[model samples]
Target: MMSKKLWEGSKQFKEHSHLHDYKLWLATSKGLKFKNYQELWQWSVTEVEDFWESMWNYFNVISHKPYSKVLSSHQMPDCKWFEGATINYAEHLFRKAKDNETAIIFGNEAGINQDISWLELKTKVASLATYFKSIGVTKGDRVVAFLPNIPEATIAFLAVNSIGAIWSSTSPDFGSESVVDRFAQIEPKVLIAVDGYQYNGKPYDKSNIVNAIVDALPTLKKVLVLPYLNTNALDNFPKHYENINHIFNTVSGELTFEPVAFNHPIWVLYSSGTTGLPKAIVHSHGGILLEHLKYMAFHNDVHEGERFFWFSTTGWMMWNFVQAAFLMGASIVLYDGSPTYPNFNALWKFSEDVKIAHFGTSAPYLVACMKKGLMPKAEFDLYSIRSISSTGAPLPPEAFDYVYANIKDDVWLCSMAGGTDVCTAFVGGVPEYAVHSGEIQCRALGVSLYAYDDHGNPVEDQLGEMVIDKPMPSMPIYFWNDTDNKRYKASYFEHYPGKWRHGDFIRINSKTNGLVIYGRSDATLNRHGIRIGTSEIYRAVNKIKAVEDSLIVNLELEEGKHYMPLFVKMKNSAKLTDEVKSQINNQLKKEYSPRHVPDEIIQVDDIPYTISGKKMEAPIKKILLGMSLEKSINFDSMRNPESVQFFIEFATQI
Candidate 1:
């Protein structure tokens, strides 16, 4: 049973008057019938076929060709969903009427507010589609975007999807090598980018990097610049490059769209190649549409006309997830600058201004806000916010408490966890579930997620691997350039046959019926034959007020023995005094075992992170072992790549 006090205090557990009105209809709805989450989960697995079929009908999935069958069988890997169904992904999203209802809200650190209503967004998308069609872009063609989270980027994405063209994007912050590494594999015919971008009150010109990428990728036929900063020289195009206006001028008014099969590829998302070259994970139109709608409507409790905001770039999968809100006719709020630009409460102020219903961000952003002593409860009237969802990393228990105490006591704190491998989440929150301190509420409705021991058997109350036992709608259709699915299989299925090993070390607490994410299984440290998670060490070390962030890794000694070594990154105002180091050691020894204590605690300036703001552990490990850093994937925005060299020197000397 859930704690009564916890249940009553959580906004998720409170009665939703909207759901109450739809309860009777939901109970008797054509494809949906469930009294509780458990019933839906059980029916989804036991009667898997009927469950998804019903979900499709309930969401009013617009398919040109009706599905011959809902599912093929109960097989984990081979199960097929909505076989023979034909649907246009864009058709479902443009369901909103041509009215003045706000569809997109764009903001930045420079105090820019650009709002696009449903009718205006439609017009822009149609104009862009006309442009693409004029340029001979037809069905199955690919268009690449290296742009920010501006309105133009969203318009480009919608236009490509509308005309059945595949869309792929990465943020402008990525270096030329990283951008080329990804777009080269896709062989995109058209490239869309901005002249420059602004972050933290500084402008960055992309002419050099963009020109390099455009020249290297021979398949790129055209370059369309959005003109963010550089706009004086009009005709600045290479031999094969053409400006966006030049292409738009030749666009005809006539638009032709082709509907495709349900499994047709819509977008290609790249995995964070911390270890190697990033893998291009492709997602289908129909599956992504259906699954995102389910997540937005039921899981997020998003209603039509509600305002939704997620602080993410086009590179992250959350950007795609946020764009899906338009399918429900909800207005999306977008920001394209540093969250702490000018002030720490930039996002909070935007939320208050937009009256956002659902606010999504990263764990580091919240932790930074906490460290800055930001209290939204005192300054902003964020009553409109019903849910706050966090991803990119596991939410610390203290962060959860900080949000409830300082942001809104009654708001739902959702710690959603999934990756680019699957466009949607495996474990997330539901509107009716009770929010725990540090637990993702439940497995996604139709997603089969469980903790498995080394023997591949399900386990509880202990740390183990998190695996999805069955395939869901949003599983990647295929990998780019992987002709025989070899790369796809090796990426996800090599660890366990026919099962997705999600690479998370999680412990399910039987007492509270919650989950505690220890850390990544690949990054798990082993000393004296005992496996330990990096988060255990982090949780103890970060508790010290002097430490801002830290990275823990296993260092192999000369005798081939392994010991835990931690690298601490202190704040600008703090120092790594001997007293603080001793305190860290004492805390670790008291909270955990002596083995959990680090052999050395060295302070650094900044921890290296990926473009999506995740700590780059594998690369640091490679650096310590004196290996090549070239193979370290996604090194575009490493905070301090040179610091790895110093770490290696220090390790050798020690």
Candidate 2:
């Protein structure tokens, strides 16, 4: 049975909502009348062209050239949106900046507190842009960063986008090899990094990692290192490093916007790379500008001068989403440390101290707090917080109740599901919509998301593949290096041909029209909302001379409950020992990330594979979750057909 609505908007909230503003504008201009969010959504999906054009025009997108057509083609991977339109992504963001208004508010576990005004932010971005131009960096050049979630990272991203240079970033927490694996593919011209960052109240110096990455990337012509922790960090690094402070101090100028086509690449994001190398998914300037404007202004209800904060590392896509706050002239709140450092109340305290209006985090964080019995409502004064957003995983029904009963009764708790692919949520928060317990309010406007059965039949109120029938502005322009579009088509289009299979198991409530995400249908581990590829784990384990082969699977035991155990096929000469386990753990932490390290390590005689010698990660994942063996895998297709019995028996023991 489905849960009841947990929270509803007040009369004041409804009348003043950005959604209401959009409705009024549409009704006055387009003569579109919608009584509710459902009616509006119906019109949005059915009249796709009008809905997107309305969104584009409603945001008053500052395009230098008008689009010839809304969508040139409707085919997936071949969809060309906003054709002939020329725009710069950073232009819209800077246009909203105010001289006296605060642009950024930052705090960290180390008790660092600082704020950057809009004027200072613009000046910093301008300075960085000038420096990049001096070094021959121009449009379409890749500028990558390995930095913490600091103001400088945001500035660097803004400056890169201002000059029409594509930007990509990863958290400093990523292992050196993992960082290299991602940045090397893009062949960046300039690399921005930090000396160190604080997490869990401990300072971690990243000079060694930065040095190694710089050495690995021969394509880098310049390296700018920020002295985040150590002021003399640049002197310690063994490279021709330029101090970020020197560039800011020496360079001063106004930013010059570089206009490009609507489909011009703005940023290059990466896939989980479970099967192979991470696919460099590229997104365009115009598409992202329009999508974010709609998402922030309408869906998130972010108003000018309001404070918006989302707990994210540079590695996650949320960091990119947070930048849109600037486009709306809202102050962005950034924290560069563990949420639970010193105590679990740290995040709530930060919110209270900064007076955040919109606070966002992952489902696991809320579940951890609930389990630990840390009641923020009873302890902290979160008076200014209006909305709390949850993503990365499904929010348990219990979690929804806990948020209202223990956190804030009046606040809206929005649980959404979208991923790195779109850089936006497919189903997310709608300020005017009633939030049902454990369900996303509604599908995002301009997104045609629905569940489909294996035979391509659409289903509601039942689990199936979460498929998007129509393309949105934010879908990846293309996978970098995918010239023939073979890899891109196989990734999404192969499942349904025309529709995009997002590879998530989900269901939409027939009555409430809210979404419930079960988990990933693929082998990627989405633990703590971070997507870690299975092959990344294999890369670390394979390096161990004693290990023969390995299989890693993340099983969703229940909502917000997961068990990721590493199964190993060890060499006959090498036995499973404490030392070997420690080595594997250390290597995984060192090479991939701490998130990918398994909760348990178990020895197996053999690892299952297909006749084509491909690792059967999806089948093994299903077997461990107690799914029927016959339905999970075909015996004739497996090279080691008898090997399936081992996991089937093991599932029963667990």
Candidate 3:
């Protein structure tokens, strides 16, 4: 099949592109000509220091102290950026704000929509920051949040960062065990939590979970609870616990942004915990600030006053990205509860109603909408939307077609792939370039992405391990509680010994210079010594009208034999007939390879997914390999934990 260009950059879009402006500036100041995005990307990867220095200036990053050097050294793990510079993350987010402009728009599954003006948001953050200082919070102190995707979570994070205190957060849906496993490692001094939260029109009381977490964390000096679900929920808790209103009402002060070193940790992000206990990946104040500004302004092409919305919980990294929209002077749209509470069109209708300019969500949501044949263009007035981004999984080519054909033909659809390690996309959308179906427009500026074969040599147009030859500004400063940097090294550098191995299977198209991600390399299928990406199989299986979703795992059996099984979730009226199986096999053989066909195709009730909507492939593979459920995955991190039982039962029969 031939690839189609979905959208072309208009003159207005080119004028708004931060990258385009930078290109013009480069030609005028540095006497360098970058005629296209490809030439600009080549220079960016070749002269890394110059590119980053230019980015720092282009974003107009506010710094209290000048850096002694642009880069201290070229070491992978020890690369120091902007040495001696001091800055505060919250300062950039709240700067250049108009009092009357909207800063945050909150929406819930129950049709609750509210907006907070810039002045109101600033006032709330100032009050919380003052209260935090009164409670002995200071630089390097940890403040953990177990809250929903409400305005309070954003305020708490800003307040924590405003004082140079490190912030960490997880969704309220996580159980006490999962929450403690993450927050306990950091030894936070303050615990910000919700009394309860609502999802899919059902209220869940999280008071007990918060109590358990507070009881387990000995370093917690104070507990602040928000009345999220039920207003009276906090009354049942102990009197020692503080109410959110008490802090907001008694404090009155201007927010002070404490300037710390560029490398000073700002927040701790946890891994998926599919293999073992979650790794607390810590990011710095200046590193995250500069990175997010570039990612949001240039890659997303976010203009001031544009409405940016991404359906995410506080647990996901995208929520942190959404917070960065304020840095670009853009209004953030926050949504809590299910994206499809009433129906699959809930988000589409809401996006139209609110006139969201830039919308972000996962590939699974788009794929489900495509399979159900939901015509969003016919139902909703989405002319206000300029771009839509999909992540969390590889977007099937069919989903790409569905978006242009059924959603909007003129809109830009970006299928980006990045992980929690860097908290940004290595390959993402570039508004200045044409978007091809099922491909990321370009490698993000300043990110040195290369696909490496087994011998550690770079290759083009062939799927291989995705690796970074240089350190990104947003790479984790360090892992919390990881002394001697042993765990951090083992996680990324162990495979290649020096470079950053991102653990994803990917290829860069030679013709279009676009990125096509296969699934995670760890979950790739290897049959008869031939490796195949899971996306190749998924593309074929998901094309069948009957299949709703699918999963495949390669198992090593007795006598060095192998068995590759494919589990499929079918539609209600569809059956896994022999003709259907034959069609799938034939499609795989013709499109991918003869080896792409699985040994057995089994029907399953549902596919397991993380709370962030990623297919739980690695965790399921571990469970099918004889590992117990508790050891494979944390149940609290799953959207439907019961779906894991199907794999465990299938493992027994094998």
Indicate the worst ten consecutive residues by lDDT in candidate 1. 1-10
User: Each prediction's Cα lDDT score?
Assistant: 0.79, 0.85, 0.88
Q: Which ranking of candidates, highest TM-score first?
A: 3, 1, 2
Give the runs in model 1 whose Cα sits over 4 Å from its true position.
1-26, 29-35, 74-78, 233-235, 239-242, 245-257, 511-513, 556-560, 637-640
Name the candidate that leads on TM-score.
Answer: 3
TM-score of every model versus the real structure: 0.94, 0.82, 0.98
Tell how far residue 389 is off in model 3, in angstroms: 0.6
> Candidate 1: lDDT of 484?
82
Tell me the lDDT of model 1 at 432: 62
Error of 1 at 617 (Å): 1.3
lDDT of 1 by residue, 1-654 (tens): 332223322443445523332344557764456676666666676666666776686667877778888767655445667889888877777786446878888999998888888777777777789888877988888999989999888888888998889999999988888888888898988999887899999999888888888888898766788778777423455645556655555553533346778888999999876666789899888779878877887667777888889999999999999988887778889999989888899899988987899999998888778776799989999999988999888877767878988999888888888888887777777766678876777776777778888888888877889988777888888898987888888877889888888899887665554566778888888777777877778777767887888898886667787766788988775789999999999998898888887878888877777888888776777667666656543456553455565665664755
Worst 10 residues of 2 by lDDT: 608-617
In candidate 2, residue 89 scores what lDDT? 90
Candidate 3 lDDT tens digits, 410-524: 8888788887888889999987778888888889988888999989999998888999988788899889888889999998999987799989999888888898999989998
Candidate 3: global Cα-lDDT? 0.88
